[model samples]
Target: AALAGQRLDVAAEAASRARALAPNEPDVHFLSGKVALARGDLDSARGHQERALALDPAHSGAMNELGRIRLRRHDTAGAIRHFINAARTTPGEHIYSRNIDVVILRTLSRMIYVFVLVALLMLWVPAVMHVDRFPFAVGFGVLAAGAVASFGLVLLRLPREARGLVRRTLRTRRVATALFVAIGGVAVAFAAVAFVPPSELPQTLPIAILITIAARITATARLRSPVSKNQRPGDRMT
Candidate 1:
């Protein structure tokens, strides 16, 4: 009731009493987290949220609140992961599902930036390894087009409202995100030559598989890295 009224003092007081009465109750801790969030006490909010999750790992409510706390901390990846987990744990919630789609689309855009880098790296085979430059250019163009189409298709899977939300959310991270894209682009460009084929496009299927493995490994590392705090599972960095 106090929480609904936006009365932090009363909420905190009630939550404290509830905690004392039900020390191991996830809902009690979640209430405490809500009170802390109402007071703009992120540290306390995070603590309580973590406690709630610890007590009940499948607590979708706790996951949702924790995701918001992560957003407040500028931890976009963490927030997205939490939101995704909340959606997966409770598939009927439209809000969580919508949030996940927005984040996923934004993240896909970032990855497309990286893949462009990877493509530049992969282009070396036709440019240097292949004797004919025309076919190499054509095939490289195909790769670039494929990457772009893939990003577009992913967006098309989302509703128009979610696409708008993703665009708005991306505006905040424009500078930093662009910088990251450039850096990743450069790194993958360097790694590209290793995956390039020797003239024949269809002949490089095994190489394509290997390059896919490398991309997945790179993506996994980004997801698992501690570059951001308060992350839920399968959080993305790019």
Candidate 2:
């Protein structure tokens, strides 16, 4: 272990010397970034890593380092996003896989919480209790069905592989997901209000709309993780 540490120290010094000789070399910047990260100089590490990535956008090392920095900062969502890009560019890397796994589990846990909340809310809402009392049950059910379909539509629109081409395609359709999610949420709110008594519709609709809008916004932001259809099993990074 001592020998290994010494070797790392020597390598770090060599990297510094290389940087001094060739300041614009992407590999030198990448190595210096790694050494700074090892020494816990996160800010300096980020500077070097970003410089390396700027010098060579295809540098998987720099991309992975930036992702690691985001992970350490507790920005799991951002970390996952960056790691996905790194993984796409370097599919054999185990580091990207490990980081991506952590983020995936975290995201799943949050999604479970949201699902549970939605289930509970559906059960307890007064409009749901007396379903037969509402004259608009048919319309409400239709709207909710549409909501479910909208979610599926978003999933369908996602690319089968997360590569340069897929990212470009997604960027082109950036507003589509947000728009669907927003409209679907509004539909759900109106459906929920349709169950209420006619007298309470005016009072309840606005509040329900606001709450639904907030929930939709949160869900849209949280679900921004990569969706790749052709990701190979045991690919290490994808």
Candidate 3:
């Protein structure tokens, strides 16, 4: 009941009692680990989760918690492994599936870092060739608009319940905010290109990085879709 209610203090007391009563019980260790996680003792949480996994090797919940802990510690690979294990061990568990998708997104983010570098290098062609400014501006605007459109598409797929919170965040000035940021990004790009020396000019890289980041941010925002071998579909709940 305590765990269900997310009353971690009460759950901790119950877990302590359970551990005393059944020292070898995997569930007790799992409960204790959950409590430690709630208290932000990641090391303790990880140890208890490992102990639970050792006792019950098929404990999907323990694997799920371990994955979350690994993510907290910035161990993306480990997190993905544990999350995959949990999802494979218990395919019906929503938490495991959701977490696996999230871990996959973290992995994709690393790939995007490389993409940013390459895309920036490609952008240099336009700068070096002295491409017509109007055409270059049009191309950049199209890319930016595409990124924004992707974000809007992703937003449409959000759960009905979550839309409220996201809408609240957008408020009534989102258009104004987007225009301000877009104009500012364009101004910065122009300034960098105009002021930086030809031999030393590396403005394309930064501009490419910014554009790629925006594109990938939209991709990240769409990550809940379960359209892959290891991915699970979003839950249909309020």
Candidate 4:
């Protein structure tokens, strides 16, 4: 109750009392760790959570809490590792799995941003260098291929279950259609620029830029939306 009320002092005191009363209890330690985390005491939080895991190695709650701590510390890889462990330890817990997906979505969002920037540079650099149309087309085709390959590599690195979840999210009808149209439009626009008269360059380049911008906006919007709308209380990522 105190934790829910944003009363950190009260929560800390109550958590301390609970730990005192049940020194061997993993749940008590987990609660203490949560309270410490609320107070921004990362070391205390980590210590309490580690103690909980020591008492009960299979404590998924402790693992999840440790993941939260790692995330707070900007240790993304460590955070993902803990979240994966928690999810694997308790496969039925949707919250742990959701946490992993959230991280993946954030990573993908950043990747999309980079892709958009590179796409813009790909267009601008060719013009500034007075590169031949064929060379420009070849360069853009390679960039598009590299972007696809990078995204694939990211999916391949995930655990099977997480990879499946990500694939399902991406495969949603709206997202898939938007991406397909945007990518297809950009490719077509660039290819047209390569084949059409130099006078048409002005028209084709703008179309490609617009498509790139649309792709970024669409991807960012989808990623920022909740991965699952059925999140239960206490399941929210910190």
The prediction achieving the highest lDDT against the true structure is: 4
Per-model C-alpha RMSD: 12.8, 10.7, 11.4, 4.1
Residue 94 in model 1: shift from native, Å? 2.0
- Cα TM-score of candidate 4: 0.73
TM-scores, each model vs. reference:
0.45, 0.43, 0.52, 0.73
Q: How do the residues 1-238 of candidate 2 rate in per-residue lDDT, one tens digit apiece?
A: 2223756677667777889999999988987888787777889889999999989998988888887787678765566667778877888876675556545434333443454345336533445454443535554465456555644553344334323332333343323454455545655665567666657865785677575656555555534545455431121332
The order of the candidates by lDDT, greatest first, is 4, 1, 3, 2
Better of 2 and 3 by lDDT: 3
Candidate 3 local lDDT, 83-187, one digit each (tens):
778878988877776664444444434444444444455456556686655665666566556556655664565444334434543342332243344444444
Tell me model 2's lDDT, rounded to 2 decimals: 0.60
- Please provide, for model 4 over 1-238, each residue's C-alpha lDDT reduced to its tens digit, 9 standing for 90 to 100: 8999999999999998998899999999999999999899999999999999999999999999999998889765677788989989999987897787667666666776876778777876545676798788788878878888998887766666666666765766544654665566567656665676667677777776787677778766755654354432122574
Candidate 4: residue 62 lDDT (0-100): 96
The digit string of per-residue lDDT tens for model 1 on 1-238 reads: 9888877788899999999999999999998998998899999999999999999999988898888898778666677678778877988876775556445544654665566556645645554555464554466567667766866775565455445545554453432354354435434543344345444454554454455545544553443344233322223321
lDDT against the true structure, per candidate, is 0.64, 0.60, 0.63, 0.77
> What number of backbone clashes does candidate 1 have, counting pairs of residues 3 or more apart or in separate chains?
2
What range of 10 consecutive residues in model 1 has the weakest lDDT sum?
Answer: 229-238
Q: What ranges in model 4 sit over 4 Å off? A: 5-23, 36-44, 70-81, 188-207, 226-238
What RMSD value applies to candidate 1? 12.8
